[model samples]
Target: MVDIEKKIIEIIKHKPVILKKIYELLQAENKEDRRLIRKTAKKMLSDGIAYKDSKNKYHLVSSKQVVGTIEFTKSGNMAFLSDKNGDEIAITVENSLNAMHKDRVLIEKIGQWRDLPSGRVIRILNNEIERIVGQFQKKKMFGFVIPLNGKINYDFYISPENMNNAKEGEIVEVEILKHKSKNKNPEGKIIKILGKPGDPSIDLPIIITKHGLPNPGEFPKKVMEEALKIPEKISKKEFKGRKDFRDQLIFTIDGDTAKDFDDAVGLKKLNNGNYELGVHIADVSHYVNDNSDLNKEAYKRSTSIYLINTVIPMLPHELSDWICSLVQDEDRLTMSLIMEINKDGDVVKSNIYNGIINSKKRLTYSKANKILENNADENLMEEIGFLKETLESMKELMYIIRENRKRRGSILDIESGEVYFEFDENGYVKDILKRERGISEKIIEEFMIKANETVAEFFDIKGLPFIYRVHENPDGEMLIQLKNYLEILGIKFKIPETMHPKVLQEILEKTKDHPLNESIQKLLVRSMKRAIYSNNNIGHFGLASNSYTHFTSPIRRYPDLIVHKMLKKYIEGKNDLKKQDIEKYSKILPDISESCSKKERVADEAEWDLIDMKKIEYIRKHIGEKYEVFVTGVTKFGLFVEIPEKMINGLIHISELDDYFIYNERDNSLVGDKTKKTYRVGDKIKAVVAKADKLTLQVDFIPYENYIKINKKNTKNYFNKKNKNGNKKTFKKKGKNK
Candidate 1:
């Protein structure tokens, strides 16, 4: 069979040959040989070793043709195809051949465009975007829904019959029926009406639908039944083989509004003066059996989606919020990672085990921080004064761990902002504040990092097939760009041949006192690769850890639950496993890793969409009001500015400026041609909210002086409706969500 397959490939290697020609070349006389050749050719085609053209001729897949998934920029005017090796080839909209974002397509290279390989889509292998969430607009006889997702440039036409009684201006979900032709829009039907756009309650739901996430409180009936069938109260028999930590002064420190306490921490000073840190994570894997409906649903979701105040949990609320949550004074089962740390903050010894713990307190970050800072209120101090010594010791140990991490080249100064909404009684946002991470948050973070690394290192050393959280090194090109930018900023830094996180850490340290410190840190972060899960272990770059995995939030993250299950198996078998089972895990874990990574990205996008909407909503209430903002981005068309206090970014169009501004690519600045004024990243200026549209999720800003002086002028038609050259308007039309 192998000989026949090799012969068939040789027959079609150099030229496009039909099946009959290959069959004849092989000299197959028997019916079995013919069937085998036919099967081999089909398998080769599917496996990308061979490609079949329109005329039913097969050629080597490497013959100027490739398979990849297409993605578009947010503006949708340009697209790129990313092949399996992460190499991207540019594809113009015209050459895209009507292929949408995320469509797997076969492309043939045409020629080089701007020195990069460009391609035209020859065939679309598959399009998985079956449903779209959009806003409906009814015309005389029919209606069309404009997609809210920025990647989709075209609209879905909804005929009168397919409208499903959807009203005008309603947000609806559309199921694509067919793609008519290259230039025509796809046809679809309205499947569900979300709500009006500006309604506060509808914003989150729209984002949820747009990202294909399950709505809040919506779970499959069988999954819910399974969740209910689990006993709410822990029975005595369930405590078998579990270590008891109920008498320890263990507690959880989360946000004030947090309900699901997945991990609790405790610290102790050992006889030799080393510290024992206990990180008890909720034992979600205990109740969620691998073959059960709950497990299926959990794996489908992979991780909980936290959209503003709404949480679409992977597990049913019965498990995520009730029995599995480590509430105060309540006994809960956990998978504990107890590590013994010396004064040098090294994990000298560690152990993982099933444990039962009754958390002594449920402390918020604010409360814990107050106690650490010795600023707690009298009543609060009186209530938990007994735990102060342990809490202070934990704080001291946290610094030790953090210093150790810093010594090992971890990049820790990157600032990620979280926009927290303060809602009124009617659920409208009254204000938005950027949540700051305090010392208490850092304590939990450091402990969780250590725990994850310990478990992952254990399994990694045992040479077991297990999932790992990996963050690869940044691309060399991006590091070069970053170095150039830093040089432009006058902060000279050398780029090593082999990049290391410590170099980035040193650059950040240099910018610690710079005016653009925060912006520079953000730019550095953007240059780094996103951390993801994989069955193969790659050292994490950002944390500077050799082995890492998510093992601290099982109730919220499915991978952590799986980690718990793997740890339990290791404990039971002492790393002994059947050869077949090892092969089974090795085969299946890669797919699981890919699925979880994809789902995690979806969850992040959904959360960001919701936050962007809320930011627009909050800005709308203060339109025409002036605020101090910093220019974070400079483009040919505009300057992207962010209000530091609110953590909201908006655009100040070039047309709004008094003089004609030319984009300086050398320094990424906008310089006035005549006035000699310049605007660049990190430049502070006062700007007024010119416009905020919820439907488009855009916020436009105008300079404070310009806003006051040209209050009645039409800024879009400014400069006498033309630029300096008088060819046309310089500012381009705003693409949806661009």
Candidate 2:
């Protein structure tokens, strides 16, 4: 109703409306009008937007309100950007938009709207996005491209000549050429024609184009020729001034399908009873020269875009898959972070230096875990006795470090759902399963975290300008709302006067194994602020680390690449950076961080959309099949049920219920008014898939009895989990209507 009121105000602002007469007009404006218009008509009178006339008909108020867009140019420090919706400015300048030009958005600069002195400038602190990408559909006369990005909210009108010879149904990248007015569709032009959407080879390209990804054409001629000239193997000459770690029994651990190994690890027990752990990362900076075309391409991409069955690498195949990859038995260049950890997991000493390494073997998580249990392939273990011993020692150190982090209030082990599909040899959907992580994954994670943290602390102590992964404290208001939400769910908890990581950890510990833990965990994560890149050292509230920066996987992440370059300069004793240089970087870093963050977000959305799209396609086949679902949310219309294993949420519409249901505003549940039966949220129930629409990415479910059922065993339906007390509680009818 609030949304309808807002929409009505926006429409009425243009002209006075005969409320009853405009019913069809309002309905035609949006597809969701059926649900919204009913409440809007009533809300209009209550909100004073409409009044009864002499004839007893409703009339809209003469003075109307609408949101408009604005763009601002800076006059010194204060930056302002306007919205498409008028003079209203909501430019939240992040640290990345500090010195952006008029062409760029002034993202993340917080400003007040009430009243301000003339010319008062504002500094930046956050960011937003620009440009949209979509699919091109040609018409008989003038063509229009439907945007794949929902945020754009409008189709792009493409001129015949501007189609760039793209055929119909091709996934072409369209750039907004002109925005004449808010009412008119923006004119666009085809910048790149990827290919037909359904083609096997075009899958990755379509996702890339839809997200405006920069997968620059097969390395420029010069870059490729240069890459070819670089010798494949690192000789003794190239290892000058670098610590020699080739004989240190180093090994790479990754998934079985992994092609690129950017990181490797080694371990040794020193005589002093301290464990010496070495995290050797591929020296991508050593190969990709700063300001080179290869480097520039990597910078533009910012980070690797990995999707289902496809990976768009930031670096070329020549580097990412070969030269820069720490392949087993091949001598490769590396930047090593060697640390001595005492029995208590405290870092007694550490050093970051360039080095050379030869990976002894590559082990997947499953294989590595088996090796840890001494139940792996015997031939290799027999040949490499030290490898097995070192892995065990590494496992020991991982646990010690993990416990140390937990003691310091670091919240690292938050469980989340993952779904992945398996395809057959012919590319048909073979199976989809929930992916799980084990101790093998954690061992590698523990090592990487240590490396990244140590590198960040080193640069911070040196007072150098670097991009830090900063997670600000959660909003005070948001936490209060979350506390209230939990209380409503019958979980009473107290919020600390001073918010800390331990506060959340304690509440989560209390909620562990509770019936509502899954949803509560997700909501808690939603309440927390998103981690973003910033040049300022505000500390990462999530990790409980005062120093945190991305220093691993330079081949994939731009910030890591930048960190490697800075680290190289300092480590090589070439630290001639001055205050002016630092100031110059201060302005430039904001834009870089903002751009990188936006690019990463774009990639994430594209990946998630593809994942959801396929999942919907998979679920559509199970229509009419009955499955157990847990009620995760309650609405006026229905109960929202979530398939536990798949993490798929679907709505069980109230209309689909056998009995007449009334929405209970008090408990936020659907109540059977006559029968005095209630269907409260968090209640488990059996439901049948009534409908699944890919276009809306929505699944509709019906109560098991109301829907036509099918054999559940054939579909492998997973049952709901039991409570901590090992009780599987079933609701007969919300406990006799409360």
Q: TM-score per candidate, in order? A: 0.86, 0.73
Give all candidate RMSDs, comma-separated.
6.1, 15.4
Please provide, for model 1 over 492-523, each residue's C-alpha lDDT reduced to its tens digit, 9 standing for 90 to 100. 87887777888899998888999778778766
lDDT by residue (143-163, candidate 2, tens digit) is 888765443445789998888
Off by over 4 Å in 1: 1-68, 109-117, 165-167, 475-481, 575-578, 708-738
Number of colliding residue pairs in each model = 0, 28
Which residues of candidate 2, in runs, are more than 4 Å off?
1-145, 157-183, 187-205, 215-217, 377-386, 488-490, 574-584, 631-641, 651-683, 703-738
**CA lDDT of every candidate:** 0.84, 0.69
Considering only N, C-alpha and C atoms within 3 Å, which residue pairs clash in candidate 1? none
